[model samples]
Target: MFTRIASALLVAGLLATSAPAAHAQTTAAKKAAATKAAAAKTAAAKKAAATKAAAAKAAAAKTAAANAAAAKAAAATPVAPKPAPVPLTESLASAGIKDALNKGIVKAVQFASEPDGFNMNDDIHIPFPEDAILMKTTLSKFPGMNTLISTFETQLNRAAEAAAPKAKDIFLNALANISITDAISLVTSGSTDAATQFLRKNTEAQLITAFRPDISAAIDQVGAGKAYAKMTSQYNRIPLMTPVQTDLTAYTTQKAVDGLFILLANEESKIRKNPAARTTDILKQVFGR
Candidate 1:
């Protein structure tokens, strides 16, 4: 019986020791499984982060490329040049008219103030009185009467030449008095001699009044009155011919004024037609085209 009890105790002790060892082994296996699961989770997270970073980098690169392409396209496109500023009609008109008038008057004055200005120009050459045709017809029949007539004609031309220099101040004064609206009208008018016509219309009476004194002085200086008297006396001596009287000052002054206007008109027309005649910046701005 003692031997049997000892065997039982030994077997029980062995079983208890085996049960504890099995429990410890089970705990170690559970801990190793948990560690493996944690390692898999960490690997998955790292892979996901790498994928997101690569996608973000690729997207950023794509955006940069698109921007570069857009920039290149902009560089390749051609840009239009800016247009020139246009001038105002009113400004153009004033400038053009002033320039044209200045040009015309200057040229007219130059021609008229020179030697044979009125005497040589056929267009303006002062002829003997139209009313004195009968006197001329009767006088030419006589011998020395023709010479005296020629002398009278020459003196008439001489008086005109002497008086032409005074025209510049008169013309400038008329220009100064011109209204802005009037200047614009003259420039915009299609007529080539519009400015000249304006001057003729406005300045004729004034010029006639102003020029008479100078013309009268010129007539005396050139002895035009005495020459005209001699011719009239010779004609009056003929019994069959009616006696003739001429207003030498009046005739010469009228002819000179007419001649000045004719020359001015011609010069104005040239300025309108010829680009070379546009001497000023304002002239070119309005009429250059």
Candidate 2:
């Protein structure tokens, strides 16, 4: 009986030790599976982050390249230069002896402004028509009458030169009405008369207003009014001479306008005759006729 009991106890002890060893191996296998799952998840996250970073870098590079191309295109375009004005040198050079008459007219007006401009200037102020000749003949017989007549003429002319710049302004203002077609025809046809025609048609009203004030101021300031009053008072006291009540300002202004038109006509003729005088390429092309 004692031997049987001892064998059963040994068998129980061996079974218990074998069971613990089997449980330890199962635990170790479960731990290893959990670790492998965690490692796979980490790898997936890193791959996704790298793909996102590459996509962002590609997008930034494309944007930078587009901006550089826009900047280059802006820098490549060129700017244009400004154009020139119409020239009149050709017409001036081509003008004939008619131009001398125009120059003479200008000299006449200039002379009228000086101290003895009209008074002593017998050459320009000589008699014209037979009716006026009688008056001249009558004045000529009296030695001191010529001196008195010349003083009045000089005062009248002094008023005229002071009014010239104002007249220039009026001419400039009226010049705008000269049509593009008219200008083109004038230059291409080689006609000096075109500008004169234009001036005659446009400048009357403007010249009247411009000449009045300037003439008035010049006459008052230049001692012309006093000289004219004195001369006229003496003339009225003459026995045979007719008493004249003329506005010298208006007469001088009319003469000035006539002189200006004559100059314009002559200048136009000169431009027509001389092609080399056309300074600009456009002028040469247009006025070559």
Candidate 3:
């Protein structure tokens, strides 16, 4: 009986020791699970942060590209024009003051048809001043001076006559400038100074270039340069007249401008006086009024 009781007690002791070992195993398993869960949570947080950072970088890059594109597009635009373009008719009408420019233009045009238009018109024709007229007075009197003065005048006429065809355009341009209101007033005003002013202001510079070649060609044709040297040499010998020297090209240019205005004014006046002359609806509408 004593042996049996001792054996039973040993068995109970073994069982109690086994229960503590099982409890230790369960605690270790729970600790491992907790650690794994914590690690997973930390990884998830890191992933979320990375995704947010990446999204921000992409948006910033897109914005920068868009700004760059906008700047490039803006740089590609052009600058605007200086003076605003007015209507052709309006600009012409504005050129004349009242009705004063009519007779001046008509007289100038008529003068163009005459012998002196380019050849004999003193105001329009140029060689040397009147004081130097003796130089061209006669070839026998001042042989060298005649050639010099003649060369200049001849070149001027050649240029003027050569430029005649261009007058059609000039006339048309002048017509457009005259408004009907301006025409009516012009009858009373009777002066073409405004037209002259316009030609001098607007056309002088451009015409200078246009006439250069013509003048040069004329000079070549007449041997004006050689003629000029001869005339100067002759003039130095003559003590009687103080010969005045002037540029024929400059003289012709000034005369041409004056003549153009005179012709424009004349045409303007005729149109104003004659209702039949205002052929177009626009012309009639403005002038007939």
Q: Could you list the CA RMSD of all candidates, in the order they appear? A: 26.6, 21.6, 19.6
Higher-scoring candidate on TM-score, 1 or 2? 1
* lDDT for each residue of candidate 3 in 1-289, tens digit (9 for 90 to 100): 9999999999999999999999999999999999999999999999999999999999999999999999998889775666543343543344433233333444555566455576775555644545446556643474354444655667556556555445444544555556556544543344524445554565556656665566556555656556665665666576675654756556655566555555565566556667876655454444554
Better of 1 and 3 by lDDT: 1
Candidate 3 residue-pair clash tally = 18
lDDT order of candidates, top first: 1, 3, 2
Steric clash pairs (candidate 2):
90-271, 91-270, 91-271, 92-271, 94-270, 95-270, 119-150, 192-268, 192-269
Candidate 2 matches the true fold with a TM-score of 0.50
Candidate 1: misplaced stretches above 4 Å? 1-85
The prediction achieving the highest lDDT against the true structure is 1
Error of 3 at 70 (Å): 85
Instruction: Give the least accurate 10-residue stretch of model 2, judged by summed lDDT.
Output: 123-132
Q: Write the per-residue lDDT of candidate 1 for residues 191-275, one digit (tens) a residue.
A: 9888888888889898888889989998888887887777788778878876787677888899999999999999888877898
Model 1 TM-score is 0.68
